[model samples]
Target: MFLRKIANAIGGLLFLALFLTFLVQITARFGFNQPLPWSDELAVILYLWVILWACAFVVPEKEHVMFDLVWNSVSPTTRRLMRLVGHTLIGGLAIAAIPASWSYVHFMAREKTAVLGLSFEWVFLPFVLLLLSLAARSWHGLVQAMNNRDLDIHEANP
Candidate 1:
């Protein structure tokens, strides 16, 4: 819950920052007859962060898109099994991505953006975070599904 709130706040701020930066760039380019070279790069970075963080923010809430028509028609036991299988597969894929993503991030460690000179690794931090958040959410969903199954079983017995 707390992480979701934080992700929301951060995503909002990133979006605001990206929007304001674009506005500034436009104003500076046309209104002032001067263009800021760094603004475009900054906007790209901010946009990337906003997108990645927004994804993370939605994962915990299961607000991401899914085909629920078939899901809703399934039996309870079958639904639970499907959920566990889905979450497990997703979680495993996410786990698999971590090291490759980490290597990609590190490959740019010494590199910097053209205009801003910000470290490329820093620029790609949100990608890494997105993967991590996805994994966390997947595992969390798996656990929740298991617990629900246990509760359902207990209720049936009681």
Candidate 2:
């Protein structure tokens, strides 16, 4: 629940910032005789942040697009097995991504944004957070599956 709130708040704020920046840029460029050069760069960064953080919300919400036709048609035992396999795979992938993303962040830690002059590592921080959240969700799913709980075809909260 706390994670959901944080994810939503961060995503919402980033999207709002991006929208306001774009509006301001448009007003400056057209209404006034000047433009905000940093607006575009800021928007890009905000867009990245919005996407990365929103994944954490989506994973637990089961909001991501999935082919649920087969899932819905499966028998109980098959469904349980599928859930176990799916959760394991997701957990493994998230675990794998952490070190890879960490290394990449470190490799580009010295690099800065062209306009904001912020470290690239800072920009990439949300990717790590996204992976960690997904990993937690995956673990939750795995535990649920092991306990003989029926996985939802479309929705679950971790």
Best-matching candidate per lDDT = 2
The per-residue C-alpha lDDT of model 2 at residue 24 equals: 92
Per-candidate Cα lDDT values, in order, are 0.81, 0.83
Structure candidate 1, residue pairs in collision: none
Model 1: per-residue Cα lDDT over 74-158, one tens digit each = 7888878987898799889989999999999999999999998999999998888888877887887788788874423223424
Model 1 misplaced stretches (Cα beyond 4 Å): 149-158
Model 1 poorest ten-residue lDDT run: 149-158
RMSD of 2: 2.2
Question: Residue 122 in model 1: shift from native, Å?
Answer: 0.8
Clashing pairs in 2: none
